[model samples]
Each structure stands twice: as structure tokens, then as C-alpha cells.
Target: MDEQNKNLILATVLSFVVLMVWFILFPPPEDTGTPTAPTEVVQTQDGITVPAAEEGEAGAPSLSPTVAQSREQALAKSERVEIETEHLTGSLSLTGGRIDDLSFTQYFETLAPDSPMVTQFMPAGTSDAYYALFGWTPAAGSVPFDQLPGPSTPWSVESGEVLTADTPVTLVWDNGNGLVFRRIISIDENYMFTVEQTVENNTGSEVRLAPYGIIARHGEPTDLKGFYILHEGVVMSTDGELAEIDYDDVVDLPVDANERAAVEKKTVVENGWIGFTDHYWMATLVPSPGQAFTAVTKYTQATDTYQTDVRLPVVAVGPGETTSSSTMLFSGPKEWETIRDYQNDLGIEKFVDSIDWGWFFFLTKPIYMALHYLYILFGNMGFAIIGLTFAIKALLFPLAYKSYVSMSRMKKLQPEMEKIKETAGDDRMKMQQEVMALYKREKVNPAAGCLPILLQIPIFFSLYKVIFVTLELRHQPFIGWVHDLSAPDPSSILNLFGLLPWDAPGPGSILAIFSIGVWPVLMGVSMWLQMRLNPAPTDKTQAMIFNWMPWVFMFMLGQFASGLVIYWVANNCITFTQQYLIMRSQGVKPDILGNIRGKTQADSK
Candidate 1:
């Protein structure tokens, strides 16, 4: 194919890939949903009934707790209810029955003052997973939780309500005495405790019930203050059944409730179960599946602790039939010694589903793991990235070297090939045959250069994924003005001088910006250096076409992770050094460097 056509084809393909990546990272808002679907449970004659549609809606809860006023007032009144035990020390709120504050001042560092670090779960409002019902709704009035105008009247506290140190107190609410509610508190060496909420309908009639629970946040979810982590585990069949489901093979699970024009969402898990976060994490799971028509919803979060809320929406029962639902709440860390507290495999680790890599995972996973370990060990992700890239380059050295040698040989034979082209003049078939025959006799492999580049493509993709998702590199620091290598570069002279986006960073930070800005410059320089060290295409079109390749690559790479950019920068530098050494060893003149001797030699030539 002619150089013009190749460039056109490559340009089209590049544009398409860019669009796809843009959409993947910044998907349409409509695509977001909760992790768990709304659950609907019904008992059939043969077994349990669960409608997938109902389950889909489990995440979209329109009902929020009735606030006395607005969220600002509630937050202002968030009480610091402290509980002391050898096993646990934290503060919760009596107002929202949530952990409004947590401190291990003597146990652990303060984390931070404005840090939204919670001792209990605090779900991200923007994330489509485990959405918590808090803040305030229209019914509570305008002004959000954070923007509430001012404090409102305090909520009335009933007398004799105290969270004391003694036999653990239990919080109970029953419909027997017009839905009486009570609070019980306790302390112990073992903070392990079980909360059993029993709801029985005794109005001599069936009444619909929606079980809702609330816990306060010592902090809210924020991008700046989250500890990135994952859960891993397996699910076993019925009690002692011994049968297990391989949760390793990932399936797309719901992140939030599906919203439809008129359809109701539901989810049903017949096998009663529980869940636990990693060892340091604690959680409370409330399972309340009411009568035949009950729809139950479960959600959880993590801070310094974990809070799981189970919402049960019950429908009417037959007049004569007494209906009841029970929920067991387990709250504690997932420490091996304590995880067993919430047995039935709840404590078992279940890794979050990740994107698959086809057959490449077998090879890429080890590389990723190695890089991750190094990142954690050194606490400097940029260095780890450099090391990983170097390892990959070393492994592929033989192939790349052969490719370079082949290209060099091709360049040496170019004069002869051009003579044949001139002699064949317009006889395309004859020219092609001559070119093939020359390649055959010379023992040249046309594909020798292509294989190495193709092999590197997958490796590049694999590393991209690793850098993008590996939590270990999230906030890791690096040396000399470049800290938090996982995030965008934090230093930018252009930005400092107001010539760029004030939030804009140096080349390593924002992938897209860096690609469009710094990548092209580096790539151009690298490619120019490479060209000077080796063959130059005879055809002006081919030379011009190849000259533009680096710019195209730079645009493509600019929007990649800072770690990836650093790797490329190192790769280019190393490649330039290698090619320069090769040219020097081959007795090639160094006119490209423009030294006084080089200039004189070039002038003489």
C-alpha cells in the first residue's frame, strides 16, 4: 500500500479507539446504577420466588428517613456517644443511631480534621453502589445537608434513654404497644454483639410494613479521602452443604437499582446469609424478609467500621393470619478471630470483579503483581513503574534487536530496490516480483519487524489496566517533585503561571491533557533521534508519513496514566541510548549531534 493510504487508515483507526476510551472512562450518566437491586421475596409451594425485575430496583429507594427538619440541623446535632470496651473505642450518635464520630486519638492517628474518614460505612453519593438514605428530601425542605441555612430545633430525647456500660442493651420496636421503640447499650472485652430485630403485626389485621434503619456518618464519602480496597471470597450452598460456587469467574453485578418508567425492582436470596469486609473492617447486616408480599433491601458501607442496613417493605397480610419477620444484625470487624463471629462464610474474602484479559492474564497478572509489590515496598510508584517497564523491555530485547537488524539490512539494500523500481517503470507486477525475489535471496523476513511491535501492543494494554486499577498505587509517592504517581502530576509551571488550567498538572498527571501536550513533544524528539541513528526512507511521502507517527502516538498516549507516561518516557530515553550506541559501534558518523567535529565531517561529506 502507498504511504498516503496507510496514514489515512491508521488515522481513522486511532480516532475510533480514542472515542471508545473516552466513552468507557466517562460513560453516559444513564449507565450508572446501584450494586444491589431492590429485593422482592415470595414463598412458592415448591420453593422461594424472586423476580429479577424487583431485584433490579432494590437499589433505587425513593423513601428517605423523615428528617425533623433539614440535614444541616441533624449534622449539627450529631451527638458524640462514646462507648468504652477493651475491644472497641468509638463514638456513635444517639440521634441517628449512627456513628457520627470516631477517634482512636490514643489508639490511632486522627486521620485528619476535615477528612471524611468514617468509623462506619459512608457510601459515595455519586457511585452506583450501596446507596445510603441520608441528608434530606423535599419533604424535609430545600437546602442540602452541607448547604443547610442554619441549625433548627433539637429533636426531643425521651427520659431514661442512656447508652451505658453493662449488660449489652438491645434496641427493640414492636407493634404490640402502638409500635413501641426502646434503646439498650452495653460494654465488654469482646465488642462482638448480635442485634435481633423482631417485627410482629398484631393490629388484629394485616398492615403493610417497610423496615428502614439509619446510621450516622462520622464523615461523608469524598474522592480525596477514600482508602481503595477490594473484598474477595466464595459462596457456599446451604448450611454444611459443603457445595461452593466459584465466585472467581466474574459476572456483571448491579451497582445500584435500575430505574424504569413504571416497573418495580426486586432481589431475592433465599439462602439466609451474612457478609464481612476485610480483617480491619466491621459490618452489621440486617436481614428482614417480611410476609408473602414483603420486599427487602440490604446495603452496607465502610469507614472505621461497617454499617449494613436492611429495609423491608411489607404488604398487607390476611386478617386472621399473624405475620412476623426477623433480622439478625452482626456488627464487628472481619478479624479472623472475630470474623468467625458472623459465620456462614460471611467472613470469607470475595474479591471484587475485574475486567478480564483473555489468555493474556496468565502472563500479565504476574507482571502486575510484581509491580504492585514493588510499589508497596518502596512507597514510590514512579520508581516501581520504571522498574517494571525496564523488565518488559529487557524481556523483549532479543525480538526488538532482530527487528532493528532487519530494518538496518533493508536500508542497506534500498539502493538496489530503487534501481529495480526505476528499471521496471510502471510495471507494478514486475516490480513486486523483483522485490519478493530480492527479499528471498537476501534471507530477509518481511514480518520480522512487525512481530515485536504486535507483541508489545498487548503488553502495553495489560500494563495500562494494571496502572489504572491497582489500588496499591492510588496515593503512593515518588521522589523529586513528583508524588502520588498514580494520580496526575501535581506540578505544572504553566498552570502556576496561569497559562494553563489552574487545576491542570504537569505531563504525568491528567492522561488526556498530558497526551495531547507533552507526549507529542517527547515522541517527536525520540522518533527524530531514532531516524537519525538508522535508515531514512527514500520516498519523500514515506519519510513524511513516518515522521508524523510519533506525533500521532503522542496524542494517543497523552491521556494515559502518569505512571504509563513515565514508563514511555523512560522507554524512549533507553531506546535512544541503545540506537545511538548501535550507530556509534557501526562506525556511523555523529553529525546528528551537531558537535564541532560532527559538523565538519558532515560538511566534508
Candidate 2:
């Protein structure tokens, strides 16, 4: 094969390799069933907080190794202040003054009408005991753990009965010996909560304590997606540096001998937050914007806890002095618009990074912006994907135009090139020299045709990552038979599009790889038709590769997000039109139909 054909085949194979190997290498992590809730119990305090590293060296508070109660039973352990906001519902446990129970009022666990609201935090005793706790950590040589309020501190309502956007709740606990603790929690119309924790010291001596916020997940999330592309673990921003540590990596964090847990700690001067992020929802602790704090991530295998803590600097209170610390807690869905608003309005630096944009952020971010606007304008994700494809195609139209024009010129040179080959016979050196002279004389480049294909590789991968963003695409319906664009195309040919009584194969079933859905089949056809715009390769093996490529991708990607499949189909159709127009402008009308028939005849022969 000529160098041009060789490059074309290599590019095609490389694209195939990337598409196939990515999923193969990084298949979803195995689901080792959510951290088993403590099965047996002795003192049912829900769960105990593991001792901290030290009073001075702040570390995350995690569940202690012990048995637990069910979520309802755990919630019942403490007197609670009911939380009711526009977008959130749940209660704050007065025991720890912890916002341990919350569910998104706007979202459901599934598309079904009866599906439960999506729960973001569960009480300490639940199988997935996830919660956010704010309290005082005593300074060195200060009061004992019991003296200051903790995860299990029993506080009584000091103010509001029900917590609402307009009505904030206050809980107070007095040590009686010398210190009194009060937590005033106020919720916004959305997800943010302002927790103002104050401690009044009435003792004769100086008292010192550090305020902190802890987000603890008793075990890995029960609803963990475990998908490689999606991040579901400890996601934090320290001094504007974003870090996404998986649950496995959290477990592997360096040991903090003082804390007796695997810990990673960072001292952030300002502009940071720490939290656990599941696929769609997140619970993060954002220190009062300008406040410096020690951010820590911790994991304890024995207790099966993953924790992130934001510990503020130590504050000292003189005799009869009172001090308070205000912090923000975000516990809700990761809506791009909402997070972006928080970042822009409240100066939550890089808060949007909590959403995994992946390595292709350069492309993914811009593509997501375009797609996001399009979704809003069109009011349908399917159309948004197609609109995104068109916007991208239009942006690259000039390069595509040049590529197609070059391909036309190369086609014009084919006849002369064949004569040169005939004249040179078996003299390979002479044939190459003549071909190079012919190309240089014509002022044409053989590689231009591959630029569009080369560009598609990154764009395709970026869009795939975008679909995994979840909030925009999850449970979103596209045109018809596509209930969830983030999920696979549901209608399968194997079930004759539901004509057969049997249903399509489940996504996890091995047969799902071949359960070609309508969208995937249409995508394959679009790709095959696009290939027909050019004459088949002269080499039988190369031609065979080109012929089978579409079908190979169809089978391989049938299980990908249907939104991506729609993008591919749109891209193929647009490309086909562009190439055809460029070909016609060159006075060589593309006979795609004839080429398809000719290929069939030749293959049959």
C-alpha cells in the first residue's frame, strides 16, 4: 500500500484501539457490596467516632468499629430539628448537631413515578451512614473529648422548631462545668447550609478549642456506580488545587499514627473545601471563604469509614469570653448551573471541579458549555447532542473543507499515479520517487484527508466524558424509545424492538454487547454510508478492514450512553454531506450509491 493508504489504515486502527482498549483497561471497579453495616451490636450508639490524631493535629472523625442500627432507628436516637427547604428535605440530628439525614426533594432514585427521593445522607446507624458534623476540637491540654460537643453530643433546641430557608434552627448544649456550646444552622433556598458554632467559656482560666466540620460515610456508598469514567469518592479542593481520590486510594492514604487511621492532610490558607462525592450527589464542607483550615481525608478499614474534615485554627477564649465559627455545608445534587452559581457568586473556588471533567477538560469543558446551552434551548438532551455535533462540525468546517478538497485532488492524481506504478514495474524506489514528484508537482498533501478523523478521536472521547457528567444527561429522555440518554439505547433488535415478548438483555449481561439497538444500528449505517463516499481501497485486506470497521464499532459501542450514539450518527451525517459537497465542488460528484453497489459486487466476486 502507498504511504497515504498506510497512514489512513493506521489512523483508523488507532481510533478503534482507543475506543476498545479504554473500556477494556478501565472497566468499572467491582462492587464489593456497600460496607456491611455493623452486623452485631453491643451498645448501639449508632456508631462511635474514632479518636482524633490529637487535639492540636486535626484529623477526620470516622465511625468507630462497632455495630449499628437501621437508618430509621438511628435517626430516632436523637431529638431532631426538621429541615425543609425548596430543594432539600431531612433533619439535623441534635445528638451531634449533624446534618446526617437529607434527600433531594427534586430528584428520585429512578425514573419510576414511585421511586424514592434520592437520599444524600443517612444517619450514623444506617448501612450507608453518611453525614456532616460540625463541632469544637479542643486545643492542646484543653478539655477532654467529652467536655466539648462531638458526633454524639446531646443538644436541645434553642430556637426554631422546623428548619426552613427563612427560619434557621439553633441547638444548645452546656457542659455545665465551664463551657456552653451552641450551633445555629440556617439553610438557603437550595443546597447550602450555614452552620455557626459558638462556644462560651465561663471558667476562670483561658479555654482553647478549634472548630471543625466532618463529612463521614460509614462505608462506601451503597449506590456507588463504580464506573471507571465517573468519580465516586473523596473529592476535595485545597487552596484551589482539586484532588479526586477514589475510595480505594482513600484507604491507601498514608497512616497517621496519631489519628490511628489512613490519612492525607493539607493546610489550606484559603479557598478550599473537603468532602465525599458520590456520582450525582455530594456532601462538601466549605470553610467560611477566607478562613484558613486544615483539610484532611481519612479511611479506617476496621470501622469501614471514609471521612473528610475541615479543621479551623485554634481559638482561645478568655474568662467569660465567647467565640463562634461559621462554615458552609453543601449537601445535594451536583447541578452544573447550581455549582457554577455557587462558585461565581460565593467565591467557592473551583467548586465545579467537583464534577469530573476528566483529562480532556480543554475540550470537555467547552463542549459541555455548548451542550449545556443547547440542552436548555432545545429542552431535550437528544437534540442537544445533535446540536452539539452540528456546532462542532461548523466550528471545524474550514479544516474539513480543506481536507475534502485535498482528498478530491488526491483522487484526481490517482490515474497518473497508476501509470507511474505501471511504468516503474517492480522498481519500488522509482515508484516512490515518481509518486513524490507527482504530489509535489500538483502541490497536494496526501495526509490532509486524515486530519478530520484524527480530530474526531479526542472530540469523541470528550463527549463520552461529558455524558458521564450525570446531572444533565441522567434520566433525560431523547426523541423516542430513549428514556435515559445517559443509559444505553433500550430498544434491542434481538427482541425485535419489543415485538417479541421477551425483553432486551440487561446491560451487565454478556449478550448486551450484541443487543444492537435502533440507535446503534442507525449509527452503524451512518458510518458505513460515510465510508461509501470514497471508492474502496485497492488492497483487499485494507478494504476488508474498512468494510468491517463500522460493524465492529456498532457492536462494541452498542452499550455506550445513547446520547453519544446520537452524536456519532449526527456527526456521520454532517460529515457525509460536507465531503459530498466538497467532492461536487471539485467537479467529481460522489456516487455513494454506485460505490456501495460496486463494493457489494466486488466482495461477492
Candidate 3:
């Protein structure tokens, strides 16, 4: 094979291998038998034992079936302190003083205007019970569990009629002993909530207790995308390092023969946060930046529950003294600006890293930032993406120009190359040597064309990551039939572009392979036209591979987000224009019509 053909094949094979490995490593979840029951009692590193269920409280069975309940039914079970803010609307449950009911006022479950708002936290007693609970755990011998407010403890609103950015709410619960516990909950204009818990001791002696926060989820969310690119499970930033544990990984942790559950804990001596992250929303517990804390992630086999906890240092409350500890709760969309603000302004370490930037974080972060700024400038995400693509192309224009110039030179030397091949016939080594010498004399680099193509791979992947994972792209509109740029093109050729009433195949289905969309088809055509800028390869195998590659890519990427498809199509068209103009400027006109006719004749022959 020629050098150029070899380069092409190598790049194609490498790209294919990378994609295959990714798909293999993160296959879709498979159906499994019911999970076994968790043990009755689960112990943490802090020596606190949590029971699977309180007496007479309805709990999930050992092999319980997946059940769902209405949001109203779940909220009606507990008295709640109403939560209202510019960006959030929910309530704080009186039982356990958990910030359990939360919905983002700005986001919805679907693109439809009437669709329900996105609810991030759900109170217990519901099928998908998830919430954040904060309280104190007495030292080993200091006080019993009943002495402190437990999960079912009822707290009364002592101050503030409603929880808002300006008006904070305080819940007070007297332990019916010498100790009284008060929690002051305050929210910002965004999603951050500051929870301060204070304990006043009136007894004669001192009491030692450890303050902790727990975020518990009864089971995996039914709406989980389960895509490998996005994380939908435990995410923690401890000290300076970040760790992510998927739901399956947590459930598959090694269990002792005597233990009914598995738990993993890490001690962070400085800054850290722990929580659960959905595709676009996250609820994390952020402790004070300079304090030492023990972070734990656990999965109970019996209850089928996933929990993350941060246990802070033990505090001693002396008689007639008051002790207070505060924690920040983040529950809302993972907007880059908002998260970065928390990281920078709130002093949360690596808080912005929670967005799951994947392997190409360096490129993805900047790409997303540029897209965000352009969106702000243009007031349209679709235009922002197009502008970003144009900017990237401009930035790489030097290399692209050099590549096209070299390609034009190579085309000009085609006659000389043919003469050398004929003179050195039947001697492969001699022909290669002559070709090399000729290239040197002509100052043409055979590898130049590969540079632009090579550079595009990383940019393409980073753009895909940005579009697929960012909340800003969700429900964003472009043009006709493209209400959601983050989703696949809704106009499928199979349906005659909406002329037919039938819908395209659902994602990941077997028939989805053939469910090509309009943007993908356009991308394929652009790629084909770019390839036509040069004559068909003389080698039959090379020509055949080149001919089929674009269609294959079209189908392979058919289900990708429309925004990414648009970028690819735009890139191809720009590349074609550059190559055509450069070739013409070099006084060598490309015979695209002749090339097409020649290929058709070869096929007929």
C-alpha cells in the first residue's frame, strides 16, 4: 500500500478500536434476578449501627418488587416546611429534619411545556425514596440513639414562615431531656442550602457526639440513562482527589460471608464533598473545607439502598454550653457556572469536577466554556455551537492550510511520480527510493494531509462530551424539527422526514441501526463530497474502503446528538472548500465530474 493509504487505514483502525473498547467496557445494564435481603443491622466506620427498618415502619422487602408511588402521596406522609426560591421549590421534612422534597423550578422532565418539573429529592415512604438527613451520633458510651433526634423525630418550625433566599427557617426539637436541638436552614438564590445544627446542654455533665450527614437512595432511579459517558451514581471529591462509583460497582462490592452488606469508607483530612449525581442534577453534602471527615459509600443488600455519608469530628458539649456545626447542601442542576461559583466562592474543593468530563476533560472544559460564552452572546445554543465550530476551524486554519497546500503539490507531481514508477518497474525498493527522492526534490510531505484529520479526532470527541453531558444543551432548540439539540435528530428519512406518520426506532434497539436521520445523512453527503475532491484511489481495496467509510460512519453516528452531527457536517464542508480553493489557486483544477464518471465506469466494467 502507498504511504497515504497506510495512514488512512491506520487512523480508521485506531478510531474503530477506541470506540469498540469504550462500548465493551461500559455495556448497557442487563436484567438480573432480584437482589437478596440486606442484613438487619449495618455498621459504619464511626461505630454507628443503622437498622434496616424501624419497628412497625413499612420497609422494602428482601426481594421486594420495584414499586412507584405518586409524588403527592409521598409528600403527604410527612409535615414539611415549605421551600421556595428563585431557582428551587420544595420542602424540608419535619420528620428527621431531612431536606427531602426538592424540585427545580427552571427544569422540566420533558420538552413539553406542560411536563412536570424535575424533582431531585424525594421523601421516604415513596418507592424511589431519596433524601438528605443530618443529625448527631453519640460516642460509643455517651448517649443512646433514642437520646438524639432519629429518623422519625418530629421538629417544629420555631421561626420563619417560609424558607427563601431572604427568609430562613429554623426547626427546634427538644430531646425531652436537658439537651435541646435546633436546626436553622437557609437557602441562597441558587441551590446551596446552609444547615446549622446547635445543641444546648443543661445537664451537669459533658456529652460527646459526632455530627454526620447522610444521603440515602432506596434504589436506582428508574429514569437512569445508564449511558457510559455520563455518571449517575456516587461522586465524591476528597481532599484533592475525585472518585466516582457507579451503582453497579457499589452493588458488586465484595461481601463477607458473615456480613449482609458491603461498605466503603475513605478519610479526608481536609476539603471534601460526597453525594449522588444524576445525569444533570446532583445532591451533595459539603462539609467545612478545613475539617477532617470520614466519607462512606455503602450498599445494603437487604434494603437495596445506596447511601453516602460524611462523618465529622466528635464535638463535646459541656453543661450550660452550646455547640453548633454547619453543612452545605447542593441540590439542583449541574450548571457549570453555578458549580464553579460554589467551588470558587464557597471554597468547595474541586466542586466543579462533579460534571463528569470524561477522559478529555482538558479539551471538554474549554470547549464547554466557549460554547457557554457564545450562547450568552448569541442567545441561542445552536448558534453558539456553530460559532464554536467556526472558531475551532479558524484556530486550526494554519495547519489545515499547510495540509491543503501539500496535497495540491502532491497532485501536481502526479505525472512525475508516474514516470518514476514506470522507470523503476519490477523493483519495489527502487520505486520507493525514487518516490522518496522525488518527494524531497519537490518538497512535498506525504504525511501533511494526515495532520488535520488526526487533530479532528480529539476535537470531535470533546465536543460530543460537551453536548451530551452539559445541562445547558438539554432541551435547547436549533431550527425546524430540532427542538432539542442534545437529542438525536427527530426527522428520520425512514418516515420521509415526517411525511409518514410512523416514528423512528427507539434508541439502542436492534432496528435503530437502520434508523438514519436527516443530519446524519447530510453529514454523510458532505464527507462524500470532500472525498470527491481527489480522484478515486487506484488500488481497488483502498477505493472500496474509502467509498464505504462515510456511509458506515453515518449509520454509526445516526443516534448521536444533532449538535454533534451538525459540527461534523460543517467541518467536512469547510474542509472540502479549503481543499478545492487551494487546488485551484495552485493552477491544478480538480476533475470531480471526471472522477465520478471514472468510478461509475469502473463499477460497470
Candidate 4:
């Protein structure tokens, strides 16, 4: 094979190998678990039944019996502290003082305007019950279990009538043992809620207890997207190190003899946050920064629940003194700006890492930032994406210029290379040596053509990650028939470009490969035109492979995010223009149209 063909094949093989390895390491998670009805048991005064545990156990506080009820039934069972904000509406259950019921006021379950609001959290007694509960665990022999407010403990609204961004609510629970436990819940204009718990030790003795926050999900979300690129389970950052624990991994954890879920704890010496992240939304506990705490993630097999906890260090309150602990709960959409604000303004270490930027975070972050700024400037994400493409091409113009110049030089030297091959027929080493000598004498780099492709791999992956995982891209519109850039192109050519009544094949289906969309087809044409900038390879195998590559890529990337497809199509056009101009600058006029006509005639022959 010729040097150009060998390099092209090597590049193609390497690209395939990289993709295979990436998929192998992070394949889309399979929906593996079947939902089983939780066994019902007697209800306790606290509303839900709690299994007994040994005193002073430093683990998940206690397991609550499963209660299956509708979301309305569960909400009606408890007197709630209404939560109202410009962007959120939910109620805090007074039963456990849990921030349970929440819904985004702006987002909907579907694109239809009448679709129900996106619900984020629900209290116990509901299927897939998810809620956040905060309280203190008393030290053994220091305070009785009953003395501390349990999950069922009734809390009276002591301060505010309604909880709004400006108004805070305080729930008071008096143990009647000279200890008063007060919780002050305050919210912002966004989704963050600050919960401050104070215990007044009027018992005439010192008492020790640890403040703990728990976010529990009864079962894996039934609506989990399960895509490999997006994280949909436990995500935590401890002392700047982040971990994403999938639900399946949590379920596979080793259990105790009692069948309790195994607990995995990481000590955060400085600052951290722990919680659950959905595809677009998240609920996390942000403890006070600059303090040591224990972060725990566990799955309870008995209750079929997944939980994340932030257990602060034990504190002792002296007689007639009050000790207070504060934590922030973030329960809302994973908007980049909001999360970044929390990370910077609130000093939450690595809080923005919860967005699942994948392995190319360094590239993805800056790309998203530039895209974000451009969106702000252009007032359209589609334009922002196009602007991003222009910016990227400009930044890489120098390298592209060199690469195309070298390619033009190589094309000019093709005759000399062929002559060397002929004279050194069947002598591979001599052919290679002569080719090297020719390349050096002509000041051309045979490998320069590969630079642009090599650089594009990471850039492509990063853009894909940004479009796949960021909330800003969700439901974003570009142009006609492209209402959601984060999703695959909806218009398919198979049904006469939606002229027919039949629907396109769904994603992940075998037939989906053939359901190429308009953008993908355009991308394929652009790529093919770029390939035709040079004459077809003399070797039949090489020519055939090159001919098929553009179509293969077209189908392979048809199901990708529309934003990424747009980027690819744009890149191909820019590359074609760049190579054409650079080749002309080198005085080598590329006969693109002639090349196409010659290839057609040759094939016809």
C-alpha cells in the first residue's frame, strides 16, 4: 500500500479502537433491576415504621418500612410547610421536617405546555419515594432515642406563616425534657434551601450529638435515561475528589447479615457535598465548608432504597447553652450558572463537577463556557454553537494551514513517490528510505495530514459531552425541524423527510442506522466533497475504503446530539474551504470537479 493509504487506514483503525475502548469502559447502563413492591408492615406514630437497631451505631440512621401510596396520598398524610419561590414550589413535610415534595415551576414533563411540572422530590409512602431528611443522632447514653426528634416527630411552625424566598420558617419541637430543638428553614430565589438546626440544652447537663443529613430514594428512578455519558445516581465531592456511584453498583454492594445495605464512607477533612443527580436535576447536601465530615453512600436492600449522607462531627452542648448546625440543600435543575454560583459564592468545593463532564472535562468546560457566553451575546443557542465552531476553527487555523500545505506538497510529490516505488518494487525498506529522502528534500511532512484528525477526536468528544449532559442545551432550538439541539435530529429522510405519516425509527433500534436525517446527510456530503479534493487512490482497496468512510461516519453519528452533528457538518465545510484555499496558495490548483468527473468516468469504464 502507498504511504498515504497506510496512514489513512492506521488513523481509521485507531479511531475505531478508541471508540471501542471507550464504549467498553463506559457502556450505557442496562436497566437491570425489576421493581418489587415493598413489604408492608405496621405503621408507627412517626408515620413510617423503623426497624430497631443497636444504640450508638454509626451508620444509616435506621431503616424505614416501605409504604406504597400515591404522591397525593403521601402529601395529604402530613401537615406541610409550604415552600414557594419564583422558580420552585414544594412543601416541607412537618412529619419529619423533610424537604420532600418539590416541583420546578418552569420545567414540564414534556414539550407540551399542558404537561405536568417536573417533580423532583416526594415523601415516604409513595413508590420511588425520594426525600431529604436532616436531624441529629444522639450519642449513646447521652440522650434517649425518644428524646431526639425522630422522622415522625411533629414540628410546630413557630415563626413564619408562609415560606418564601424572603420569609423563613422555623419549626420548633420541644422534648419536654428541657431540650428545645428548633429548625429554621430558609430558601433563596433559586433552589437552595438553608436548614439551620439548634438545640437548647436547658437540661443542666452537657449532651453530645452528631448532625446528619440524609437524601433517600426508595428505588432507582423509573425514568433513568441510563446513558453512559450522563450520571444518574450518587455523585459526591469529598475534599475536591469526586465520585459517581451508579445505582447498580450501589445495589451490588456487600450486605450485612441483617440484609442491610453496605455503607461506604469517605471522610472529607475540609469541604464537600454529597447527593443524587438525575439527568437534568439534582438534590445534594452541602455541609458547612472548612469542616471535617463523613460522607456516606449506601443502598438498603430491605427497603430497596439508595441514600447519601453527610454526617458532621459530634458536638456537645453545655448546660443552658445552645448549639447550632447549618446545612444547605440543593434540589432543582442542574443549571450550570446556578451550580457554578453555589461552587464559587457558597464555597462548595468542586460542586460544579456534579454535571458529569466525562474524561474531557478540561476541554468540555471551556467549550461550554465559550458557548454560554456566545449564547448570551447572540440570544440563540444555535447561533452560539455556530459561533463556537467558527471560534474553534479560527483557533486551529494555523495547524490546519500547515496540514493542508503539507497535503498539497504531498500531492505534488505523488509522481516522484510512485517512481520510487516502481524502481524499488518488492523492496519495501528501500521504498520507505527513498520516500523519506524525497519528503525531507521537498520539506514536506508525511504525517501532517493526521494532525487535524487527531485534534478533532478530543474536540468532538468534548462537544458531545457538553451537548449531551448540560441542561442549557436541553430543549434548545436551532432552526427548522430542530427544536431540541440536545436530542438527535427528529427529521428523517426515510419517510420522505416527514412527508409520509410513518414515524422514524426510535433510537438504539437496528433500523435507526438507515434513518439518516437531513443534517447528517449534509455532513456526509461535505465530508465526501472534502475527500474528493484529491484524486482517488490508485489502490482499489484504499479507494473503496475511502469511498465508504464518509457514509459510515454519517450513519454512525446520525443518532448523536443535533448540536454535535451541526458542529461536525460545520467543521467539514470549514475544512474543505481551508484545504481548497491552502492548496491554491501553494500553487497546486485542486481540480475538485474534474476529480469527481474523472472518477465517475473511470467507474463507468
Tens digits of per-residue lDDT, candidate 1, 291-368, equal 222122212211111122233443344444444444443344333334333343333222111222224666657767
Over 432-551, each residue of candidate 3 has an lDDT whose tens digit, in order, gives: 778788788888887788788888889998999999999999999998888999988888877888789888777666677678788999999998878876545434566677767778
TM-score, each model?
A: 0.54, 0.91, 0.89, 0.90
Candidate 1 deviant stretches above 4 angstroms = 1-72, 76-349, 352-365, 421-430, 490-524, 527-539, 576-605
Instruction: For residues 1-605, write the lDDT of model 4, one tens digit per residue.
Output: 34667866758765895585466345676674756554321212222322222246533334345457888888898898888889999899888788888999988877776889999998777876788887777776788767777576788999998899999999999999989999999999998999999999999999988887778787789898887777889999989889999999888777644325566878899899999999999999998899788888877665666778888888889999999999999999999999899889989989988998899889999999999999999988988988999999999998888888888887677667667868998887788878888878998876787788789889988998898889998888899999889878888988978999999887666677689899999999998888876545544566677777788788777877888889988988988998888777776766566542214211110
Residue-level lDDT for 408 in candidate 3: 74
Clashing pairs in 4: 46-152
Better of 2 and 3 by TM-score: 2
Q: Which model is ahead, 3 or 4, in terms of TM-score? A: 4
Candidate lDDT (C-alpha), each: 0.41, 0.80, 0.79, 0.80
Which 10-residue window in model 3 sums to the lowest lDDT?
Answer: 52-61
| lDDT score for candidate 3 against the true structure | 0.79
lDDT agreement of model 4 with the native: 0.80
